[model samples]
Target chain A: MGERTIIPFGPQHPVLPEPLHLDLILEDEKVVGAVPSIGFVHRGLEKLVEKRDFNEMIYVIERICGICSFIHSQGYAQTIEGLMGVEIPARVKYLRTIWGELSRIHSHLLWLGLMADAYGFESLFMHCWRVREKILDIFEETTGGRVIFSVCKVGGLWKDIDNETLKRIVTVLKDVEKETKKMADVFTRDYTVQKRTRGVGVITYQEAIDLGAVGPTLRGSGVVQDMRTLGYAAYGDLVFEPIVEKDGDCYARTIVRVREISQSFDLIYQAINKIPDGEIDVKVKGNPNGEFLTRLEQPRGQVVYYAKGNGTKYLDRFRVRTPTFANIPPLLKMLPGADLADVPVLALSIDPCISCTER
Target chain B: MSYMPKSPWLVHYDASSCNGCDIEVLACLTPLYDVERFGILNIGNPKHADIFVVTGSVNEQNKSVIKNIYDQMPNPKVVVAVGACASSGGVFRECYNVQGGVDNVIPVDVYVPGCAARPEAIIDGVVQALGVLEGKYKNMVKVAK
Candidate 1:
């Protein structure tokens, strides 16, 4: 080792969306080892379930990560509904799926922009987010909130979309799909993007499983594990395969998100077309007496929520195991052999949502 | 306008946010909102930043970090606290680690309020911060005189 030096990567960095610090041990421009230090964005949200009632806790849980805010509420709503033995209407199920898929598309687009920025593609980053503005517009029109949408509640939704508006969203999404295709083509087919990403952070198929990776990180490594296959919401009725890449490098992971965006659009179309006309929610009578665990797919990976309610308004405990937490070990695995210059891109390939991880 | 030398360079720090306001802050930079037209530049180093934009509430661990970034910023600097969490610890105030609001640690010049402050609100806050920055510059000049 040619005079090893430990350099702190960040709690604050330009390329990173959230504060994720890593102490990278470098030897002659190559990263010899890396240790991640998180919690810069931690707000201790899970404990708030004790202070907030089960009905009200969805608001707090939803703030765990703004990118996946609706999905968190959806997962909480589903788990509590499970605990209370409440079955929502088919329409609500389909609506949740639609929103969740929209969320996925938005999130992946945001990641694509951030990843482009990471690799020093400024114009591409701007273009990607410009296309993303359309997605945000849809969110504002439907959910009423641009970022942290509080549309989801226990048992069902707080608001319902009219069939006409739902149809409008489909057309709007088609335009978004075209714009996204233009940008995603640059991501996949571009020479510089491939040069920066390909073989930079290679994780083998077996190593991915051994390190407990999830979402695109796992799927990118040739594993066909997607929590959507479990089908908690309207995903059961939807048909799509997990987009897998055998290369297991940064490029593979980026391509996985790009392909998933198209898949999300297709899923949303199916949900809106098959949506049933009925009451969105059922009446939830009492608080949950038992614990329930539910898994949901986020843009990054699988998020597992465990809630233990004590039959009171308040819950005994709430736990959110976000995908970034699971992806960190695999990140460390990727870092050792990488050039120190590639650290940011490699760290970003997992799309580290530090707030989600820390929360 | 005369007092201002160049467009303000910003240093943003996330103390203890949910990444809600953070993304909105970023949204301000992207092509649609495009704060760069106003000559605002987002930079990493605290020392070079003229406007220190903080998202999220003050927490025990990051209190020193906030202070360090604040201290490093030269005089005539303005602190814009974006989002409810940074303003008054919107939801996570009662949490053990949080101290509630950026003001608890550093003096805030602008408070942009929202659960996750919208980009428009964030831009408005920056515009407000520019005024605060000019006033501070005037004061610095007076002090020198």
Candidate 2:
């Protein structure tokens, strides 16, 4: 097995829907080492921020990665708001929390669908996405876009959710919760899914922390840390604990995400119930001053945004440390020694967003 | 040969995108609307593929690679431009580094429109491409006769 062949697993692969090239040194069917080459989707987003005004930069930042669009926008906006020392309205914070949780549910459902497809569970894939479409519909109705919800503005949200709209959201989410529970039962308890994912890509608790894995990937490894626990945006008011599992395997990550979706549902319900009546946003007087750092809990993990703004309409510098970028090290750790056939599932478990990583 | 719908293996190439369109492209292959049922499966190598699904607008750094991939695909292959960015540069059209839609680099057989085209639209475009493939195959049969 020492005399092994090196195979390139992507830049283009059917099982992996993202543009990532992994050179896998294989001994028979098992991977000995893996080298990942990204940047296929690098759009020069960081450089583009220099050209746009800080106000207009929200749209650009939101486009950095579509899967975590809301988080990117929220991070950038929060950074600018922090620099400006602008306290966002309470109502807006609750709204942001609701939208953020919705984004999480949709993102996890999408991951579940992709993982199912990777393991040849075609029916489960379709069923998961079929439910996901309902979430997208909600996004389209609330934010006016399916993937890039450009709803986060500098001071607060771009729009407000009326009581009627909030009621509708609650009603819709209740139905979604029931269906999702059934799906979670299948994903967590089903023999076939467990066999394919359990004990696969096992990353120990110490290894996950050392590798800087975030989101469900790290939480599955028994780390109860969630950036949202720090109380950004209305999460402080929500009563919940970060979902954690001890196994830290592919199946554990799946369970963490499935359970987290239910948690998001409860968080959204709380947001609707506790949302106070107030102005959605405050008028900004001038450009933001000084450097600001903001961290937000995205569906994938913790996303950090830093902005240094001069006393001008355009920003001096803006940088985003996306969750997928942080999880890459952990991905590299888990890939070696695994069967070549399991590469796609392991990759999906971390939920690599190449656009986010490269951006 | 009776008309067997040749399920052309698809190779996805991301030149420069926000990944909104990339995820939607994956959605096309996922279960709710299984594109594989039509025999279209995603392959990682360009040499083993018959269709190129190019997402995002082509960037200067990736232009050569995109062209190389397009050329590597076997002759009689089809290229489908997915998403607004791949179709007309979408939001990133005005960026200096962009070379506009994928058509600037390769001939596209079909265009799936949307900032990030929906999975349903992607399925429609792929089905339409299959029809085009059948037409081309029939022409070859006619020439052989």
Candidate 3:
């Protein structure tokens, strides 16, 4: 450990799904410091909201990133709806919860598969992805697209889910839960995965909170704070608790996600079972007139949406505090003092989505 | 003598993408439509890869890294451009940072088309790459045998 070596991990790496460049300062293959440079995928999405109308901005927000598209749109819509004093129908609230949780399942499964790939476990990667396809098929069946499901509208949802479709979704979710449990068992017990992930990136509960870490990353550190606990959307109707761990290691993060996927399954089932029958959306008679700040728990973490409308078709301003962006500081902290081999897995444990961060 | 199928390890590079396409690329390996059945594994190190899946349009900053990765991959490699941006610069075509499609920098073997391509399409593209791999392997076997 005489001289330090600096390695630029990626704005483009095979295992990572986003454009995040991490400069790792290594001392004899042990990381000493990590600096993250983002903004590779920034498309000025927040700025675009100023140009697009409040209604059209929903589409723009959905395009923020494909994996977290639904959450961004939902966060944006919730902010606007809050400002306008619009009460969404009960069925729509339940539908939003169902979709939100489904999106979480898909996202967590996606992350699990990528984590497996990063650790050189090709079989586990394949197994996780096979289950993810069922989720995507459900998305295609209910919404229109697989990735960017622009289904959530400002006032309500763009489309209504029928009882038959709801039943089918429930049936599919049951199968997904069974398969997800199998994968989770394997992921937790498998020697190679354990070797690669367990205790690799350990962040203390205090460090996680101080660094502004949210979602599973924070929960993995033994923090029980989840925006869903605030009871937005139909989460109020559902009875579930946030999944937490005390270890704050890569494995703990993995467990948090795996358990969260199961929780998402339950939430979706409950939403589907308790879904009411009513109009999906309400008509907005006038342009928005005030500023609203709203928060929602995305698959990654808590996403804050701030929107200001000046009683015009076009919004005055729109801003989003994405989870990946919030978690970066903590992620950087987790990288140092780890083996070079564990860099990718450690970075991925936070589930950094560069597009979301840069947006 | 029977020949073993070449397991083409993949190296994914995001030149200048918005990450929508990148997520879908990752989805190709998740439980939904696992590409690993065909031996498509994501390798972080470029030297170990047999295929380069370049997402996003080529940009000034990442162009050299893309070329370096393309050149570093062992012989008998294929490049699959996995989005409209990578294939034709889709929505970000005219941006100052974008240098058109990925083909502007590297020779792409297969093009998966979509705003952010679905995982199914990405798996299909990798399957198509196997055809290219088979052809290259046959050429190698003829030289050896």
Reference contacts preserved by each model: 0.74, 0.56, 0.45
Segments of candidate 3 deviating more than 4 angstroms: B1-11, B27-52, B58-60, B70-80, B87-100, B103-111, B123-145
lDDT of 1: 0.90
lDDT of each: 0.90, 0.85, 0.82
- Chain B TM per candidate, please? 0.96, 0.89, 0.90
Q: Taking chain A of candidate 2, what TM-score results?
A: 0.98
Alpha-carbon RMSD, each predicted model = 1.0, 2.8, 3.8
Across A270-329, the per-residue lDDT of candidate 3 in tens digits comes to 888788899999987788988999889999998888888899888888888889888888
Instruction: Work out the TM-score per prediction.
Output: 0.99, 0.91, 0.87
**Per-residue lDDT of A1-359 in model 1, one digit per residue for the tens?**
59999999988777776778999998989999998776677778787887889988888888888999999999999888888889899999998998899889989999998899998999998988888888889889988998799999898998899999999999999999999999989999999999999988999999999999999999999999999999879999988888999999999999999999999999999999999999977888977999899999988899998888888989998888999999999999999979988888999999988888887
Please give me the total number of clashing residue pairs in predicted model 2. Answer: 5
1 or 3: which has the higher DockQ?
1
lDDT of 1 by residue, B1-145 (tens): 4646358899999888888898899899988999998789999988888999999998777888889889998887999999999999998888877789999999999999999899999999998988889988888888989
Highest-scoring model, DockQ: 1
The model with the greater DockQ, 2 or 3, is: 2
Question: What would the per-residue lDDT of candidate 2 be over residues A1-359, giving only the tens digit for each residue?
Answer: 36889999876677766678889999988898999886677766677666788888888888888887887887887899899999999998898888888989998998998899899898888889888878888898988888988889989888888899999989999999999999999898999999999999999999999998999999999998899999999999889998999999999999999999999999999989999999999987788779988888888998888888889888888888889888989999898889988998998999888888877
TM-score of chain A of 3: 0.98
Show the lowest summed lDDT stretch of 10 residues, model 1 chain B: B1-10
Candidate 2: what's its TM-score on chain B? 0.89
Q: Which 10-residue window of candidate 2 chain A scores lowest in summed lDDT?
A: A41-50
